[model samples]
Target: MIRGLYTAASGLVAEMARTDVISNNLANVNTSGFKKDRAIFRAFPEMNIHRIGDPAVLSPKDKIDPKPFIGVLGTGSMLDEINTNFSQGSIKNTSNPLDLALTGEGFFEVQTPGGVRYTRDGSFTRNQQGYLVTGDGHYVLGLNGPIQLPDGKDISINRRGEVFSDGSFVDRLLVAAFADQRQLLKEGDNLYVSNQQPLPSNSEVIQGALEGSNVNPISEMVDLITAFRAYEASQRVVKANDDTLGKAVNDIARL
Candidate 1:
């Protein structure tokens, strides 16, 4: 009975974790360059049950009597790590000269206060210092350093991430990729940080374009309903166990 109570409790905890992930995904459904997260679960290992203090149970080789194999009992399930899906999102054309998007796997390097961060969001603009920066005003890094645009000059970014001002080559966009994308950790504001050395990305730069979040609202709603139902079922199990314990302690003891 205690084990059953523990199992039901674990179900509640796991469902809560799943709900958190789904909620976060739904919240970021409209966020640009956002990637959806998935919650992974694992089951506890099953243990073998045997009859105690029985000679036949200990000695199964004896033909006179044989030990019986009992059914397995499940302890509970646990919530594992949450994995981010790095799949490409839909590209949207805004006709804004500063807006940019990547056509393949890679991230744009930005200089933040903390350190260098990476992002897929390409909505950039020129700051007061004539330096190219992201929407949040973080400096966008280039091959040499921060990209600077001359005032009153038309800007053009080519497919190969080369920036040109009045048809004069300025700098190359520092787009980078990692061998293992899973090593990248998420920071707030759609930024990512990683310890792995970056590799040259083969992605093409699309000017005046931005990427949309890859989250599917319909599927996330379905998952939310399922998680709520599972949590309710676990609550019922816990209530049932409590009632059983109450009956045993009060009613049966009085009898």
Candidate 2:
């Protein structure tokens, strides 16, 4: 009975973790260049019912007589990992010269307060210094360093991610990729830092657009409902176990 209670409790915890991931995904559904995360679970090691807490059960009854094997019973499960989904999101055209997006696999490099960071958010603007920067003022790194746009000039970027003004090449945007994308750690506000994988230089960039979040609202809503149901079921099991324990101690013991 105690083991059963623990099993149910584990399930509840796992469901809670699942719910958290789903909620985060739903909240970021409209965030540009946002990638959804997923929760992974692994079952606990099984317990042998016949040999549980009994050393005497290990002895063979007879050499010829077969002792039927009892199947292993599950203890429970838990959240093993939370993995980021790197799949590309849909693109939205902003018609702004500063706004950019990646058509293929890549990330735009930025000089954040914490140092160099990576992001998919391409909503950029020219700062007072004529430097191309994110909406939050992070400098956008380019092949020649921070890109500086000429005042009142029509800017255009090609599929190759090169910025041109008055048909003259100004600078090329930096699009980076990771060999092991999973090693990247989230640093909040959609920025990522990666030390496990070196940045790859082959990714292409697209200008005049921004990548939408990869979150799927319908799927997340369904998962949220499932997590809630699982949590409720676990709550019921815990309550039932408590009631049973109470009855054994109070009512039955008194009788």
Candidate 3:
């Protein structure tokens, strides 16, 4: 009964973790370039149950009875990891000259206060110094370095991510990618950090647009309900175990 209680409690804890992931996804439903997280779970190793009792029940000097395997008993479950879905999000046309959207796999490289970081958010603008930067003022990087746009009323970006101001070529946008995308880690502010160096991406850029978040609200709501129900079931199991333990002490012990 005690082991069963612990198993049920483990399930309850796993469900709580799942709920937290779902809640975060729902909150970021409207966030630009946001990706939803998935909660992975794993079960503890199972123990083999025998019909004749444990083989260690007898001393080494004494003869032991044969122990036939009956079944396997699960210990508990736990939340393993939270994996981010890197699939592309839907695009929205902002019609702003500085706005950009990626049609395939890629991220924009920006020089932040904490060194370099990558992001899918393309809501960029020109700073007072005429340097292309993110909404947070991080300098957008080019092939050479931080791009410094020339002063011009006409600013344009092509499908190849090349920038042109006043009909004069300036520089190309630094769309970066990694060999192993799974190595990328979220660094908040819609930014990501990777241990590997950035590589050339095949993504095509679309000016005057931005990518929306990839969160699916309806699916997340359904998962939330399922997690709540599972938690309730685990809670009931824990309560039942506690009640049985109480009866064993208060009633069964007296008998």
Q: Could you say which candidate leads in lDDT?
A: 1
Q: Superposing all C-alpha atoms, what RMSD in Å does each candidate have to the true structure? A: 2.5, 3.3, 3.4
Stretches of model 3 off by over 4 angstroms after superposition = 52-66
| Candidate 2 regions with alpha-carbon error over 4 angstroms | 51-69
lDDT of candidate 2? 0.86
Residue-wise lDDT of candidate 2 within 108-128, one digit each (tens)? 889988888999889889999
In the range 144-252, model 1's lDDT, one tens digit per residue, is 8999999999999999999999999999999999999998999989999999999999999999999999999999999999999999999999999999999999999
Q: Estimated TM-score per prediction?
A: 0.92, 0.89, 0.91
Residue pair clashes in candidate 2: none
Instruction: Sort every candidate by lDDT, greatest first.
Output: 1, 3, 2
lDDT of 3: 0.92
Give the C-alpha miss distance for residue 189 in model 2, angstroms: 1.0
Candidate 1, poorest ten consecutive residues by summed lDDT: 57-66
How many clashes (backbone atoms < 3 Å, residues ≥3 apart in a chain or on different chains) does model 2 have? 0
> Residue 14's C-alpha lDDT in candidate 1?
96
